[model samples]
Target chain A: MKWIPIILIVGLLAPFSLNTHAEEKSSEWVKVKGMVCEVCAYGIRKSLMKEPEVQDVEVRIKEHKVKIVYKDPKKSLDRVKLAQILEDAGYALEGEKP
Target chain B: MLRLGFFILALLGTSQISVAHPVIFKGGIELQGETQKKDSAFSTTYTFSPYWAVAAQYYEMREPSMSPLGRTFEASTVQINHLLKRWWNEGSQGNIYLGAGAGVFAPQGLPSEFLARGEVNADWESTTLYVAARYIYLHPDFSEDVDFKKLRVGFAPYVLEQEGLNSWFILEWRQMNTEKAEVTPLLRFFFRSVLFELGSSLDGDFKFNFMIHY
Candidate 1:
């Protein structure tokens, strides 16, 4: 039982440290094209809001672009799904390759 | 009056400095073809409309052939509409409006003294208020010396109307000393404020129109 205290302390501290690291994760900015008008932008914003990991969506009508920030970068988002959201909202997605 | 209108818009914009309005510049292009029992005609039209202000619309139409051998004619018209609109049920986001306007038309074959003009329209929106029924009166000639009598009714509903896409489906009936009817459905797409429209009229004619706003 001599090493029991040290092992328990390390086990507890490791999880706590990992929790801090997870909380410190920063989101990346994703740019989307063809986001024109408040109506179109609002639709995308609403659809993305359903994802718990999504933090915010900002659409610039003049530039026809959208900037999305997510809370967790590790969460895999389906690009095709996002593209479909845009298409249904009456916009053509661009700037995926370049 | 134009300056006063501009000033009012400026004040309205300033008052809502932190908020955004739904108003935006709009334009439309139309291609129409009509054929009676024996005569068929084709025409292209362009129009520009400002948001939240009275719109002065102009149209130039041409009849490539009016007779069996192809007698051609051209006509032009200008309309000024003073529109008053109201939006209701913010949650539903629907719109209803009643408006009246006047217009003047100069056709090739009609006496210039019998000028044509007058219009009234009422509209309702389900998802977006884009279509309406309009009644207009036109005198085929109005030169400065003669009084003319003509009236036309149109059931025009916009197929698509947003900041980016605008289209109209129009069916018209006329009683200008005669009874006639014309149906047309127009499809238009807008990109960068430019509009391209394709239309088919009941008279079994097809046409296209392209327009840009500067």
Candidate 2:
């Protein structure tokens, strides 16, 4: 009975505790290539939305740019992982690697 | 005004935008439908690669039809088109596309035949103004070939969102084969995934066109 009470309390508080540890604000302006049409913009946005860390996305069709905001202040995301996600969605970075 | 406009597009489409950007991006699916008088067609295209796409279209005539097979007939087309190249100038925002398409014309009650198509398209756009022109040729096995052309100039009176509604005022001219040219000023509106155009020609004829992308 004692173990059961402790386990219940820990399970209820784990998610809330984890949320407070790595609270960081990060934003990046991703220059995406081959976005000449509206569908291209939509597809890029949709693919970026799949990232659990991503909280906001703005796609500029004419400029071929995608602005992304990722949550979690302490832990920054990997640029290579972001590039892979974009490539799988049928697009590439505009200027340089990552 | 119309004659001056036509001359400008003819000059620009021949030597301009085609040099900038040629092809749209890969991984796009477009569905288009057009109805004129008693004839209508539904077409859908899926881009399989960066510069290649397969298109399927079904056209039908309801009444007073002028089809190669008969007055009333149904036809379908399956084509594969590719963007050959694109050109962009040092300080230009518009691009040009040159593409070729080869397809089969399957008319009901007749043998399926092959057709070849060549098209040149150019467009220049800004925050408010958009101008586009395209010339297309369809060469069939029979003498019933087609020279189709389109010119459109649009102005946006309002700002639009990516996932919301956008509206534009477009003046368009379309010529189909040997018929008289049709000129209309239409209201072009689009949401995130759907586009609709409605207008009327000077002769009181109404026009409706729709397109969807996924």
Which model scores highest in DockQ? Answer: 2
- lDDT of model 2 at residue A98? 23
**Docking quality band of candidate 1, CAPRI definitions:** incorrect
What DockQ does model 2 achieve? 0.07
Fnat, model 1, is 0.00
Residue B73 in model 2: shift from native, Å?
5.8
The best candidate by TM-score is 2
Interface RMSD of each: 12.4, 5.2
Over the stretch B103-198, how does candidate 1's per-residue lDDT look in tens digits? 343344653232345545444333322334444444444332211122222222432232344343433332222324445455545454344556
Q: Please give each candidate's TM-score.
A: 0.37, 0.65
* Local distance difference test scores for all models: 0.39, 0.59
- Among all windows of 10 consecutive residues in model 2 chain A, the one with the lowest summed lDDT is A89-98
Query: If you assessed candidate 2 against the hidden native complex, which CAPRI class would it receive?
Result: incorrect
